[model samples]
Target: MRLSHKLLRDAALFLILISMPVYYLAFTYSLKESSKSRELIVTRQLTSFQNTLKEALWNGDSPYTRQIVSTLGNIEGVSSVVLYDDKMEKIQESNSPSKRIPFSHDMYKELESNQVKQIKTKSEGSFLVSLITKKTDQGLEKLGIIKIDIHYNDLIKSAHARSRTMLAVLLGIFILIFFIQFLYLREFLIKPLSDFEKAISEMNVYADIKLKEDPNHVFEIANLTKTFNHMGEELKNSAGIINQQQMQMINVSKMSALGEMASGVAHEINNPLMITTGFLERIQKAVQNDPEKYSEIAMHTEKALKGTQRVAKIVKGLRSFARNGSKDPMQEVETEKIISETLELCFERFKYGEIQLEITKTVSGKIICRESQISQVLLNLLNNAYDAVTEMPSKNKWVKVEVADSADQNKILIYITDCGPGIPKDIASKILEPFFTTKETGKGTGLGLSISVGIVEEHGGKLYLDHGHDNTRFVLELPRA
Candidate 1:
């Protein structure tokens, strides 16, 4: 059965079970009370009958006595009202109300005591028999006795009828209460829960979206909905962060692969470049004695050597940078060494762009870090600086690198600043966010700052923009060895 029907059924059964004993007790008490009422009424009537007899019999008027007896017999629950003397002589009689009372007349004990009583006598049948004794101021006068047949059985039957009626009323009230409870639970409790379940069943597992709120919900349901919606929002935000982290990892993987290829290619080209440089050196030395025919050849050879050496320097920078140094040993390297080696990877860009580069060493110390990773950080910053001022005129373009110790003397600080317009206040905070960039399309991937931030943090350092600077400046702080 559905929950509504089952709840109602259980409630009804509980009511019936709980009410039966109460009904029985009520019925039993009612019957007892009815019997008491009947007795009291009968007692009062007997007293009145005796008082009437004392008046009538005192006058000794036989017609008046008969008239009182007839009037008494007409009262409710009284079958017959008859009078007799102590010598067993019948004086007056009334017709029986329903049935005749075939009772012995000798038992007039209740009338002797002036209270109501039912006397059992041996006769042809059985019935309620009452008696009364009349008295006067003269003495204990047995003026007359009444034989009243009170209908005890009828009184009991009436009590049973009334008790049954009351039990029926109580049962109806219980049913009505159960029915009302069922409707309330179905509308406010059961149906709302079922609707919530259906909404959940239709929701997508991968999506983090809010469930619609029901304005009519109770506190418990409303609280549940609020918690669910809050959880969905939290999950949605967490998913975005997780996806960014995943993309960062993928990009790092690609860079590591490219680094490995660069390492391999540099190794293959190193021997040929060295051999060619040696041959060109010997040719220049051998042709130096002849000025006329060998001058152009020597000049061309010098140019060839210069270009070849530059290629060699670039190849060496590529090899050094291409090292996957995440697990490399941390060491204390001179501040000058780190800067000079990192510039080798991007020095050509500065020269090609005619961007004046300035280097300042306010404080000198060995920094504790993985050399290759630190070089990567410096290279990224240098490249960004180069790109920043690359669009400006030669005279207007400049980049500065400064090395110093932090105020606490516990960290090494490297500041790279460019003459390009500084990052806007609005976009500055978002620069470190993955895939968020200010550069035009194709010029930047936007992962550089985010990945650099991660790298510096792994090395127990920080990389952040220095808002105090007038131009675009980045501060990289690493622990001092």
Candidate 2:
């Protein structure tokens, strides 16, 4: 449960906690009031008995007075009853033989200001005392008084019975309300909050932020859900801005690398072109001097042709590697040729740096994909391999390129391995992520591997670094057509 929901639940529980006793007390009060009303009715009935006692006294019939007192005593909860004559002398009295109650003289004085008085005794019962008067032509005459004792046990039992019944009823109501509220809150508040927490935890820059729009009746939760969805939308927009900036940065990085390599590429082509021009001039002079020296000129002519072809190959490789802007048309690209040309582009850098290169070709196959894109992937891998090996202190540092058909014959596998300090285990997972690199800041753009991976994946291929090895090795697998 969220803290807010927990607080709400706690508050509800506190209310239930406080309300139970309050309900019980209110019920007790009501029962007590009812008991008092019953007691008042008993008092009234006992007071009415005084009229009978008064009639008997006025007739001077002692037996009738005793009979009246005895009848009043026969009622339930009535322990005893007593009647007094006009002179305050007890003329008639009736008491339960089993449970006797004693009357006090002070009770008579206490009844002076009121028509009825009640006295409670700790051990036996309670006393209901009333005044009896006779009507006369002058006005009213004070005839006598009546006192009745009520058993405490009977009144206590009745009160307890009423209290137990009400408490049971209130308990049922409390439980039903508590369960209904708990289930309601779990569905609307608690479950949604839990799901919201999970959703937030899983949220990322490219994650879809849309959530199920549920009908939650609570205003605060509904508003909070709306705000959360709005925040997700804002975050998504921010992520789009970030991604755009990242793409721009990646483009800049690619251009910077191309600019840096332009000179080396020019040198590679210029050298081959210069050789081809020199060889052609020599062949022309030999042809002009001696038409008879045709065999000697033929060898020079062949060397010149080879030189021109080398220049053409370098230029073609450069063009392929530098191909940019999205629409990469699919074609049958030879994996071996792509790897060789990529190596050719890197040859000038390798020669100047004295980094040894080894090529191992096991099988040749063509794959239907964008040739420039594949060439770009190969160039990136070869350049990264060159850099990796060049950075090492060992003079024997070398990069090996291997192209072979997969065992299943459905795919081509290219392995680029470098005998240099391999990638550290800690940073291996992040190598293909944009802007992640171990190279010195100004020396590396860091988007080489990321871009390479993207291109390979676009062709339904996979590029991955092989871990748990002595040297750094990257594998590229593309489906063969």
Candidate 3:
């Protein structure tokens, strides 16, 4: 799931995998130690038996030999006892129908060599026995081997049971410790980290910085959380500062554009004002003439008034278009009407520059957008296309605007295609970014595409450059109303 949890789980599994072999090794070592202890005990018991037999043999009595055998046989974990001579002949053997003694030449050789020997044999069950002899003080030279056989199966069974019990206890302890640590980690680490992660993920870069505090967490996690919170605060503050700077830049750019358009707006207003003033003077002159001519003069004056009004409207539109602000409210506007109006506004520039415009309206539906804003968007695209085509030396230079309905019939798609050197693949993605323009200084404000993008997004639409085709196509897809 999460990185920390995965790491913790992997660590736990690794510990278990690593501990298994160690546990087995410990069990094997414990069994070996137990076997060695059993061997030592058997050796000591056989040594004592040998001493008893030596004492009996030095007494020079056969009855004492039988007595020694009787006493040795009564020893627990001892199956049978045998007394052997120096000639390798059994001198006295404690005969029991239920018990069998395993005596071999190796046993006698070991006794003569004064070495303790343990031999295991499989009969009714696995058996381990030791053989040895001791010297007598009477010099009778009693070369008697004391034999003690033990059930190897019983010893092994006991060892296995003890090992299993030990392993079970060790495992229980390990589990308990692991769970306790897990609880501690969860309480002091995991919960705090989770809270910190959630806070960081929900943090807004544009909004005020807010840090969540976790006093219950461990020192390391709390410190990390504090560090991340500080980073988020710094980022938020920086973003706000950058946003203010950008707003100021946009305002400055808008002022510059308005300054440049001031002369054109003045000319527009002067022409209308002059016409209106002239029409009023004419009306005054006609009023003094024939009464019939007064009616015609009034109509002509009305026509002049309409012309003046149209010029005033154009100036107002220009002023509004150059203003920089947040997007206007969306409305249902005809795509073809917006395109035509934008072209009409820029018709003078195109005529003066001798740029050809090919406008194609394939769809005649209403698109959800602001009419003035969408007109500005189209104007920007057309203007950019005009500049691009004029810069190229191609004989067939034209800017084409095509409008069509989306395949789903739920949206309208506008494509502005230019027959000029297409934009390079490297810089395509940066084209819509604010202040990113390839135009020469003083020729562009670089806010056209960026503002256009904002307008498109405000209308719940998308504006993108389509470079897959041969021509540079700026596509605008707006939802249908």
lDDT of each: 0.77, 0.76, 0.70
Candidate 1 lDDT over 199-263, as tens digits, reads 57765545755666788877888888788778777776787778777877777787889999999
Q: Identify the leading candidate in terms of TM-score.
A: 1
Task: Name the candidate that leads on lDDT.
Answer: 1
User: Which lDDT tens digits does candidate 3 get at residues 1-481?
Assistant: 9755775797679667866675677666766666667667766655665655566665656798788776766655566666665565667766462656456676455444334566656522323433434445764354545555554445566656776777678777877887788788777777776776777677778655555666866678778878887888889878866985786577567666774586467666777588777867777676867787788877777777776765665565566555543456667777787776677677767667667786766779998776867877888888888888887776667778899888999989999998878888778878887767788887775778987898889888999998787998899999999
Q: Across residues 70-103, which tens digit of lDDT does each residue of candidate 2 receive?
A: 8887877677777776567877777744565666
Instruction: Choose 1 or 2, whichever is better by lDDT.
Output: 1
Compared with the true structure, the alpha-carbon lDDT of candidate 1 equals: 0.77
- Predicted candidate 1: what Cα RMSD to the true structure? 6.7
For candidate 3, list the clashing residue pairs, or say none: none
Residue 372 lDDT, candidate 1, scale 0-100: 85
Look at candidate 2 and tell me the lDDT of residue 334. Answer: 76
